[model samples]
Target chain A: MNLMMLLEMASQGFADRGAVQNGDQRLSYAELFSAAGGAAGIAREAGVEKLAVLDVSSLAVPVGLFGAAWSGKPFVPLNYRLTDAELESLASQIAPSLLVTSRDRVGSLSKLPDTQVMERDEFLERALGAETPTADWSMDPDEIAILLFTSGTTGAPKAAVLRHKHLVAYILGSVEFAGAAEEDAALVSVPPYHVAGMSAICSSVYAGRRIVQLPSFDPDEWLRLAREEGVSNAFVVPTMLSRIVDSIGEGAEAGLPGLRAVSYGGGKMPLPVIARAMRAFPDTNFTNAYGLTETSSTITVLGPEDHRVAAASDDEAVRRRLTSVGQALPTVEIEIRDENGAKLGPGERGEIYVRGEQVSGEYLGRGSSVLNDGFFPTRDAGSMDAEGYLFIEGRADDVIVRGGENMSPGEIEDVLLEHPAVADAGVVGVPDEEWGEAVAAAVVLKDGQDASSQDLQVWVRERLRSSRTPQRIEFRGELPYNETGKLLRRVLRTELAS
Target chain B: MGQLKAGSRLRSAVCDTEVMVVAAPAAEVELSCGGAAMLEIAAARSGDGAPAPDAAEGTQLGKRYVNEAGDLEILCTKPGQGSLGVAGALLTVKEAKPLPASD
Candidate 1:
């Protein structure tokens, strides 16, 4: 089924139920559907064939979102945080017909055509006041629905084109994985531009679950909301999770009475941090999810069950399982391939590849399509266990070349995380003419815990080989990371450079 | 002052609907202020000092300042920063709704 069916089902199942909610504005399924219908009419009047959304994280954004979808045009949401040059590049690429935004935020764009600009209030006014569209708006399964650009944190962003089927698979698969029910309540804070944020919204809606929306990520407020709203499910980066765990100290149980599960991603969750979370709230099912903007939210998820089982058993088996990203999602097909594109056997280290309805075939820009025999090369170095569980080694771009040996930041970072005092860790290769590249680490100590740079260095050296151990360690309050929680190793490298 | 328009042609790429009044300086300003503070922009209406035609509907100018963070539709008015005694008006538009679902 397509995304339209999801909306139609929600409209039919829970017409009077609170469908979309913000602070003062809450719209029921019927109201939202009708409002979007009204927006579809406005889009038609504006002659918008391919609508480009400028601002997404707004209350009115959903209206434009549905309206554009109903008009059967792929909705491209640009990253509002990109540089002007980056934005111009993206704008040039899309060459959209209409620019959709709010009246109050209309003065910002540096460059654009003299295209019709639909402000939020004006669009809503016209949508609510005007007649709904009469055109028979429809979409095929293969038709692109939403186009999301990469974070571009490393370099120029590549747009990932998500079709209706991909979104459907993501929502359905996530809902099944979470085992969410109508009684479940989700607290969503991730940005809508990201796949995680989008999937969270869809899964909650499809499951007929209530969602408590947070405009942004705030540690204290997030915990407060979880406790106050009786929030059952939520998504957070590992860093955010660590902050929440710290806020809720040892003695007093942080009043998360209703919170049953919390999904953590954007980076690896250190074993100690996972243990801390487990100790603090044994009741909360903390899940580890792994995905990029390229493949919806998560193609693989390590559920709470795995965490408990792994933590309970002291054997390497559990730690090894926990280290990996766990088995692929039921809907996704996973493969491990060598440099030459030949598939590797189980228990071999190679590039992780995913092929499924959830996987996109081509990027929107200069990059080639992933339709190489229908597998998207994740560019992440990984290995599959004999049991078929996937373990991410590191990103292909993140691999550091030493004199002759290759070093993966993931390997060093994982080792550093083993230290009890280390809360979060990131390893990057620093330029060194002698060795060509040297491994360096940036680590954040646990709250109220102190570990010097030498202490961390010795700690890593003890566990790993002399060559694999980080040559230098930098102590910091926290490592720089993107909104998704992925460590910005390049930042650490820049710091070392300076 | 010349009667030139203050607002430029806004593309979706440059705008954020959550935070109503956007003042993107030609250069990046190092904002030292943390947390949410009342942001005041010397906002000039499009084309002329007069607000948009829709803004004249007895709609409070404050309602024009939509804080996407709290999703609060407040009545924002032009006031001196000294009056508020706030350091800077750096509104953080962090998270937003999910991208639109397709077909």
Candidate 2:
């Protein structure tokens, strides 16, 4: 049966439970399915052959997404923050038959092509007003369902086509990882435009658990929602985690009692923040997930038990193991390869490649970035431990060569984060005439706590060798992170150069 | 309580100006004015819709200002300005006298 049936089964299974919540709005499984089915009819009516959905993270997006998929049209969600010029360029390429946008975003579409635009009001009038369609679970497993775009290092975005099978795998994997039960509720703050956000929404829907949708990220709002909604699970990034820790300070008193599971990924979670979170919320299970859009959100998860063992121990072995991303999840495989396409051994740093049923062979629309071997080269520099745990050193693009010494900026950032005054930090290699590139750091300090550049420099020197320490430290009110909470080190490099 | 009418219209006079307000709760409202020289609109009172200030709210006149464009000038309350004399309603362009047909 197709995914449409999954929703029907979930609705029947959890008819009485809350399926989705946004602010004061709530929709049960039955309500959500009915709404989705009705919306599907509206999408069919709108002639959305290949739907381009501009979604703000909300309960409405998933409902609309189901409708789009059921109607057998690929739903392409565009990042809402993109400039008008960028939107127009993408619109010209996609040439969507129907554009789904909120009323607030209607004005932004002035430059777009004259497609049939369905604003929020129009969506409600057509979708909610129509009768709920019957659940027959139409479409093939191989059929493309969603097209996700990756912001390229060169500036342009590449669209990754995700099929129904990949989505199914991602949802199933997350369910197993989180051990989602009907009693559980997931609070997702990630925007629906990204793979992580969309995957979380779909997984919660499939699990028939309650999902609390946060329209945007706000630390205080997140804490309040977790408590108020009694959220059991959440997917967060390290940056957001740092903010939450800062807002709550250190310990269980500032903890979320109902939050049983908290998964973080996107960028590397600093050891310090991970430790502090463990100490503060001893009852909560923290999981570190590693994946990309090409792999349908996550392929590996370092579970709570691993985090506890690592954080509790001062032993070098334990701390070293903590640096590694956990072993591949069920049905996922990883391989490290050098430039000549030769497989690298354990402890050898190279490009991290992954293969699985969840992992797409090639991107959907424009094809994937994967090579002929069916392994999507993650462009992440990493080494696999003898235990088979993946230890990511840095992005292939994040390498720093200072006086012929190759360095990973992630290493310096990790060391800097250990400092008490540094709340968040990112290191980038700045061009240097002598060293070819010099290590530079941009940091955000803990609230009301200021650290001089020399303070950070001395602190780093105490921990790492002089070569690994950042030669320059720049204090920032905030570090630049994308919607996915991934540090834009490329931006930091440019900032330092300027 | 009696079933609320599908639509309701109210007319209130402020400083000798009788303004007819159309209220369509939870629905979009469209109002057309008669014989006014120009029209001005106040942005939504609250980001989330909150009811307009009531009479007992002491007729707090918020800032009064005028929007001037070519051939039209509109006077209304500025943000956070609430006053009884506040012109929070719309105005229409006064009809021009019919121009005599040229030979």
Candidate 3:
């Protein structure tokens, strides 16, 4: 039941296979197992309530994660990008913890009370050098495995709790044990604090896939590593992919022939970006994975076949699926529900609700948010088509209500993106005296291309109803996006409203 | 015999095979391995005897076995020289339909 069990099985199944790699440093399954045991011994001797990592992806990540599980403590990864004050506030929340961070951050982070700080190199040295403890991890499925802080783009971050059972069910249901080829390697560039990063480590371990870590994301460096390491699989946020596509240049080969599959999520991907990416990596299979931190990673995936079919089809409905998130996972059931909690039929816009063994909608202090029927309200606005394809509009709170009519920003933004000159777009509801609210848009044009605001408005009016057209359109150099590729819609709303 | 529930781990009494229940019918059913009743993972082993010749089909690690009715399924956690069965009928390996790797 413990996370250690997955590692144990992998170590036993393939003792000599490389489990993780960072630069030139590599660790086999057996080596990682003993190191985790060694790190667990340190956590136990330190008597911390939890083990926290405050650095980017590195060798210490897996050791810290599995070590925490072996010691029967929750593992917490803090955002290294946070400011000192913000970092201190979060560090204080998880007091009496073993904090692992870089050498430069040790002095400042060590000031917290009831905390023991160790640099990453020292931590790894001690973990690898210490005596290994006999496998004594508890098999309690209900034990807290990880405490992840939500990105909280709209408000303060809250800790989302993931139990061992929730994660194990997710892995066992989605992945086949030892199903990977002997030479398969997965490239992971997401920070350690993100849910995708943690799940990548766990899934790669159980699948017997070698993990290649990128300390920080750079398009040239990513391309270099993929070429040098023979990486066959990878995961990226929309921003990273967009940059990689741009870096590859137009009509030029990406030069990464070894890559077989690439999955992107964490934000809504613009249609143009994905279409261009497909052309850049002609042989790569693209998957759009959609999930939240509370869902333990991806709940729905647009598979490789769907991508190929959608890209080649002339039918508008079929081609549009390239922008959809695809169908729900076989292990999960997805429903679109109206505000009254009643289920909506196909093509009816509503909030997304999910029911599955992997859903843990509970926060640290707030009890389970799962309904009596075992469904978790995802608070994401989306619609399901007749064929079970799910199209995510945006966050439910971002929906615009203009003159008593609810409108999705995603729908309007998609129409705008179809315009040849438009490169990116964001739609928001601005306060109006007569209608109570009016549709407003901010757009970025393609390089060296020009389009007037009135012309863009006409483009939307021609495709969709006049009521859905943007009343106010502002042209900008570029739209704002967070580090993880999520659009800062709240900021746009504020600027446009004023 | 007791009704098998998901997450319950069982081990063969006469061999090294161990399995965890993934799905089971509501009703209690006889579960056996190597022509002998299975024991709970924590329960004491009956003896160190070998599997009966007729039942020694062997089990592989990480493979799932299911009964004919499809109402019972178990995941082999440890490989051993014994085939799982229900009422003298041997179980077959369940083909897995793997979901696409996301993240």
Best by TM-score: 3
Q: Runs in model 2 with CA error above 4 Å?
A: A151-154, A173-179, A361-365, A444-466, B1-103
lDDT digits (tens) for residues B1-103 of candidate 1: 1111111111111111111222223333322111222222333223213322322222111122323343322212211111110123333222222221110
Q: Best DockQ goes to which candidate? A: 3
lDDT of 2 by residue, A132-238 (tens): 86654453667777777775544678778788778765554345212356677888888777788778767777656688888889989999999988888888887
Query: What is the RMSD, in Å, between candidate 3 and the native fold over all Cα?
Result: 1.5
Clashing pairs in 1: A54-B12, A57-B96, A102-A120, B62-B74, B62-B75, B62-B76
Model 3: clashing residue pairs? none
Clashes of each: 6, 17, 0
Error of 1 at A302 (Å): 1.0
For residues A1-498, could you state the per-residue lDDT of candidate 1 as single tens digits? 245445555666566766666666676766767777787777677775666666645556566666767777777766656655666677666665566664644665534653456676676677667665553456356667778887765876778888776776666444531234555677877766777767766676666666677776777888877777678888877777777777877544665757788787777776666677777776777777788777877888777777778777888866678776677777688998887889899877678888876787568755546765888988888888787777887687788888888767887888877787877788888888799988877788877888888887788778877887787887788788886667777778899655
- Candidate 3 lDDT tens digits, A1-498: 778878988898898999999998999999999999989998999989999999999999999999999999999999998888887777777788999999999999888788899899998999999888988888778899999998877998788999988888888888888988999999999998999999999999999999999999999999999999999999999999989999999877897878999999999999989998998999998999999889888999999999999999999999989999999999899999999999999999999999898899989888889999999999999999999999999999989998999999999999999999999999999999988889999999999999999999899999999999999999898887878888999899999999
What Cα-based lDDT does every candidate model obtain? 0.64, 0.67, 0.91
Q: In model 1, which regions exceed 4 Å deviation?
A: A83-85, A102-104, A172-180, A250-252, A345-347, A447-452, B1-103
**What lDDT does model 3 reach?**
0.91
Which docking category, incorrect, acceptable, medium or high, applies to candidate 1? Answer: incorrect
Error of 3 at B86 (Å): 2.9
Q: DockQ of each model against the real complex? A: 0.01, 0.01, 0.64
Which parts of model 3 are misplaced by more than 4 Å? Answer: B44-47
